[model samples]
Every structure is written in structure tokens, then in C-alpha cells.
Target: MTKRDIFISLALMCLWGFNFSAIKLGAMQTDPILLTALRFTFAVFPAIFFVRRPPEAIRYLIAYGIVFGLGVWGMMVWSINLGVSAGMAGLLMNMSIIPSLAIGYFLLKEHLTPYKILGAALAIAGLLASITITDGSVPLKALPLTLIAALSWSLMSFVVKQSKTKHVFAFSVWGMFFALFPLVLFVFIFNGTQPFIDLPSQLNSEVWFSILFQAYPTTLLGYWVWNRLTIKYPLSTMAPFTLLTPIFGLIGSIIFFHEDVSVLKLLAFALILSGLAISQWRPKKVEITSAKLKSECK
Candidate 1:
């Protein structure tokens, strides 16, 4: 990656990191699923007006919408409302890489390198450590729910990869179009019309900030830049930078929500981040010659 690309990736990661705090903020005010619905609504309009639909089968788009919208994000916000702290939620959500790798290996027949295996081991260790934490951040239900969110993320990845759409952004927009109604339906069914009745009164500046920020920047612009980066760089080059999201997430939570940091939390952070980092790592290959002792591979 160029220095400019590096900088752009870092900036994007920062925005994504802070998104967890935003999710917490918005979900606190309204039904989590409804907030996600608003996010997709804004993300889809005007922008989706200009974007053409992807050529993938309708099933792929629908599946993409379902897993990406409700599975990954809807569940994530709900998990926060259930008692997972923003920082911890970010940390747990990042574990999607594990399930993603499993999908690639089992379904796509991708080979797993030793580093990735070891990295996964370390990450699982971090998760175990998280189980031992006494902080109220990780409630009994919160961990499982967040893990479901992560798994949904992996499924979303599968949908995207399986679709093999050159027009990724278009696919995302159209897919999310399918997701909006389902989300609203879920809100009405589970919570009743009361939240909807209260919707007008509930959408204060705090809620607006949270929703619009998530809609425009985090969902639309964030994915746009991310898709561009993935096209320009090797997946390995791009993947490690995502670790910054959780780090920034932790920082944002501390600043915005005063999330407590315990020793166990630190250990989990170290393990998970290290695993993700190592999973994406590739050692530089050195040239071997009988006559020449040393040569650098570029």
C-alpha cells in the first residue's frame, strides 16, 4: 500500500472504530433493530437512486441483505443493548475472522497457513480470557449474542464472495434495500407499535447524530472506500489495518461512555489483536543461492 493508501485506511478504520460508540448511543435511545432500519433507509435513498443493481441472482442479493443487515449489524446493536460494552462488542465482533476462515477452508477449499492457525489459537485464548472477566461489560447473554453477530458477519462475507459481483457497492445498496422492510417488520412484531408511535418523539439530536453518522459515513461512505481499497490492494495488505477498528473502538468507548478497562479485557484485546495481525502476516521471502550468501526479496 502507498503512504496515501495507508493514511486513508487508518482514517477509515478510525471512523469504523468510533461506530461502535455511535451504535451504543443510538440503541440506547430506540429499538436497536429500528435504528439499524433507519441507517439502511438513509444509506439506500438518493444514493441507491443513482446506483444500478448488481447482476447477481436475486437470491444472492436477498441473502446478502439478510445476513449483512440483520445478522451482522442488527444483532451487534442488539448485543450492545443487551449489556455488551462498545469496546468489548468491537473486540468480539472482530472475531468474525475466525468464522470467515472456517468458511473459506470448509466451503471454498482455501488452504490455511500455520500463522493463521496459530493466530486463531491465540484469539480463542483471548475469548476464553474474556469469559473470566468480572467487569459488567460482558454479561451472560451479551457474549453469545455478540458471537452470533460475528458469525453473521462471516455469513455475509460468504454471500459477497459467492456472488462474485464486480459492482460491490451496487450489490450492497440493492441488498440493503431488501433488508429495510424486514428490519422494520421485526421492530413492529417484537416491540409492538409503541416504539414506532414514539419514533417521532424519540428522534432527538443525539439519535439523529447517531443514525445519520451511521447511515452516511459508516454504512455508505465507509463501505465505498473499503471496497475501493480491497480492489487496489492485496487482501493481506488490507486486512491487518482493520485491527485498528477495535483499538479505536476501545478508545472511543473510554472517551464517550467511560467504559471500564480491566486486566482481563486487556488480555483479550492483546490476544485477539495479535491473532488478527498474525493471521494476515506474510514473512518476506529471501533469495537462496549457493554462491551468494545474502540477497533481499522485494
Candidate 2:
């Protein structure tokens, strides 16, 4: 990767990292479900009017939207609001790679290497370590919800890989469109019209800034650039940069939320990252199925 590309990757990582702090700020002012709905609202409208829809099945688009938007993010924001620390949430979310790899093995018949198994074991052990952190700082109840979020993200990633969509950004936009309605319905069902009615008055500048930042920079810009990079470079070359996300996540949490970083938390972070690194290991001559297509730098 060129220095410019490296800079872009670092910027994307920072955006994602700070996103946890942004979500935490927004959660303070609005109901998590409602905040989620509003974020997608900005993600979908205006831009969707300009960006062409992806040439994929409507069912797939809807499924991606539901799984990625509702299942993953809804659960994530709720868990954070329920007291899951932003840094821990970011670290736990990385577990999505495990399920994604598993799905690839079962469905895509991708080679299930011994390294992956070892990595999975290490990750599980790390998860166990995370559970033992009974330091009253971490919320035990929110962990399951965050895990569910990661599981949903894994499923979403599988769908994206299977679709083999050429226009990833378009897919993201349309997916957000489809996701918006369900999120709206969720807000209505759970929080009802009261939050919506009071939303404008309730929102302070910081909360509004969080919502806008999440919608534009975090969702639209972040995914667009990320997908484009994946197209331009090999997954192996790009995937490692993602490891930086949790690191920045932890730093951002400490800076913004002043969250405590315990010893066990540090161990869990190290082990999980090590597992991710191991899982990403591929033979030098190995060809990735997804990279079969030639890259088109537009």
C-alpha cells in the first residue's frame, strides 16, 4: 500500500474508533433504538436519491439491511446504552470474524485450516477471560447482546461476500434504505411516538453532532472508502488495518468516556487480536476466492 492509502486506512480506523464515543454520546440524549433509526435516516435519504441502487436481488438487499442495520447495530447501541463500555464493545465486535470464517467454511467451502481452529480457540479463551472481569466496571448483562450483534454482523458479511456485488457502496446505501423502515418500526414499537415527538427538543448540539457524524463519516464515507480499498488491494493487505480499530476504540473511550482499562481487559484485548492475526494467516502462494476478480481503480 502507498503512504496515501495507509493514511486513508488509518483515517478510517480512527473514524470507526471514535464512532463508539459518538454512539455513547448520542445514547445519552436519545433512546438507543431511536438514535439508531435517526442515524439510518440520514444514511439513507438525500444520498440514496443520488447514488444508484445496486444491481442485486431485492431480497438480498432487504436481508442485508435487516441483518446489518437492525440486527447488528440496534443490538450494539442498545448494549452500549445498557452499560457496555465503548472500548469493550469495539473489541467484542471483532469476534464477528470467527462466525464469518465459520460461515465461509460451511457455505463457501473455503479451506478450514488448522490455524483458524487454533485462532478460534484462543479467541474463545479470550472471551472467557473477558467474562471473568467481575470488576463492576463491565456490565455482564450487555455482553450477550454485544455478542448477538457480532453474530449478526458475521451473517451480514457472509451475505455481502455471497452477493459478489460489484457496487458495494450502492449496496450499502440501498441496504440503509431498507433498514430504515424496520428501525422506525422498532422505535415505534419500543419507545413509541414520544421519543420521536420530543427528539428535536431533547437533542443538544453534541448529540446532533454525534448523529450526523455517525450517519455521514462513520456510515457513508467510512464504508464507501473501505469497500473501495478492499477492491483495490488484497484482503490480507487491508484486513490487518482493521486491528487498529479496537486500539483506537480503547483510546477514544478513555479520552471521551474516561472508561477504566483493567488488567484482564488488556489481556483479553491482546489475546483476541492475536487470534485475529493468526486467523488471517494464509500461505504466500494461496489465492483468495473473493479476489478472483480483477481490481478496477475508478
Candidate 3:
């Protein structure tokens, strides 16, 4: 990757990292579904003008949109509303890597190296340790919702891989539109007219700022830059940069929410980072004449 691409990738990670705090802030006043709805509503305008939809298989696109946009965000919003800490949520959501790998292996028939397996194990273990070591009691009620969010993301990743779509931002915009109805239904089923009608009219500046940041910076610009980078670089080269998101999330949590960091949590973070590194690490190559000959024949 070029230096500029690396910088863009880092910027994208930072944007995504700060999103946890943004979500947390928005949750303070806005109803979760309504907040999500408003986010998509804001996202649609720029997307409509700037992004051109890819002419690809409709099934994959619809599937990607539903899983990624509606399913993931719906569960995430509910989890946040049910009292899952944003920092913890961010950390746990990284668990999607496990499912993502599994999908690649089983669905796509991709080869999995020993290092990848070990890395996945370490990451899962670290996540478990983080949860066990928390000082405050975990909200069991929110656990299911959070897990659902992670699964939704995993599914979305696979769906995207399966999709014939060439334009990620365009697909994302359409996905948000697809999510609109389901999100409204979700809010209606859960909170009914009560939360919808009773939302605070005293909309603080912070809330609006949070919404705008999420829609424009995180969702729109972040994805745009990220998609461009992916197009320019190989997936293996680009994938490792995502590890930075959780790091950013942790820092953002500390700065914005004053989340306490215990030794155990730190250890867990280290283990997770180590696991991610292990998963991506390449072994030393030993060139062989026979291998070269076989490649030439193919």
C-alpha cells in the first residue's frame, strides 16, 4: 500500500473507533431505532447524489443490505439501549472475525492455515477473559442482543463476498434504504408509540452532532475511503488494518466515557491483538524448483 492509502486506512479506523462513543452519546436521548432511522435518512441524501449503484445480482445485494444494515444495527442499538457499555460492545463485536473465517472456510472453501486457527482461538479466549474480568455485573439481558449483532455482521461479510456488486458505498446506501421499514417495525414492536412520541424536543446540540458524525463521517466517508483502498490493495494487505478499530474504540471510550481499564481487561486486549497478529502473520517462504515447475505447467 502507498503511504497515502495507509493514512486513509488509519483515518477510517479512527472514524469507526469513535463511532462507539457516538452511538453511546446518541443513545442518551434518541430512541435507538429512531436514531438509526435518522442516521440512514441523513445518509441517503449524499449517497443518492454521489454513489452509483452497482448493476449486480439483486439477491446478494438485498441479502447484504438486510443482514448488514437492518439486522446488525437493530441488535446493536437494542444492546446499547439495554445497557451494554459501548467499549465492551466494541470489543466483543470484533468476535465477528471468528464467524467471518468460518464462513470463508465452509461457504467459500478457502484454505485455513494453522496460524489462523490458533489466532481465532486466542481471540475468542481473550474475549471470554475480558467478560469474566469485568468489575461490574454483566447485563445478561443484553448479551443475546449483542451476540445477534455480531452474527449479523458476520453474515453481512459473507453476503458481501458473495455479492457481485462492485460499488460498496452504493450498496451501503441501498442497504440503509432497505433497512428503513424493518427498523420502524422493530421500534413499533418494542417501544410502540410511547418512546416515539415522547422523545425529548429539547434536542441537545451534542445529539445532532453525534447523528451527523455517524451518518457523514463514519458511514459515508469512512466506507467510501475504505472501499477505495480495498479496490487498490489486496484483501490480505488491507485486512490487518481493521485490528486498529478496537484499539481506537478502547481509546475513544476512555477519553469520552471515562471507562475504567483494569489489568485483566488490558491483558485481554493484548491477547486479542496478539491473536489478530498471529492470524495475519506470513511464514518465511522457501522457493523450490519443483514448485516453480508445477506453477508453470498450470
lDDT of 3: 0.74
Candidate 1 Cα outliers beyond 4 Å, as residue runs: 1-9, 227-242, 286-298
Residue 147 C-alpha lDDT in model 3: 81
Clashes (candidate 1): 0
lDDT of 3 by residue, 53-102 (tens): 67766777677657766777777866777777767878767767767677
Task: Compute the lDDT of residue 77 as modeled in candidate 3.
Answer: 69
Candidate 1 per-residue lDDT, tens place, 81-155, comes to: 888888878777867766767777788676777877777777777766765774787788777778888888778
- Top candidate (TM-score): 1
Q: Which candidate do you rate higher for lDDT, 2 or 3? A: 2
Q: Please give the RMSD to the true structure for each candidate, in Å.
A: 3.5, 5.3, 3.1
Could you tell me every candidate's TM-score relative to the true structure? 0.88, 0.84, 0.87
| Local distance difference test scores for all models | 0.80, 0.78, 0.74
**Residues 37-58, candidate 2, lDDT per residue (tens digit)?**
8898998888888998888888
Q: Candidate 2 — which residues are off by over 4 angstroms? A: 1-11, 227-244, 282-298
Question: After best superposition, candidate 1 residue 196: deviation in angstroms?
Answer: 0.5
Q: Which residue pairs of candidate 2 clash?
A: none
Residue 139 deviation, candidate 3, in Å? 1.2
Ranking by TM-score: 1, 3, 2
The TM-score that candidate 2 achieves is 0.84
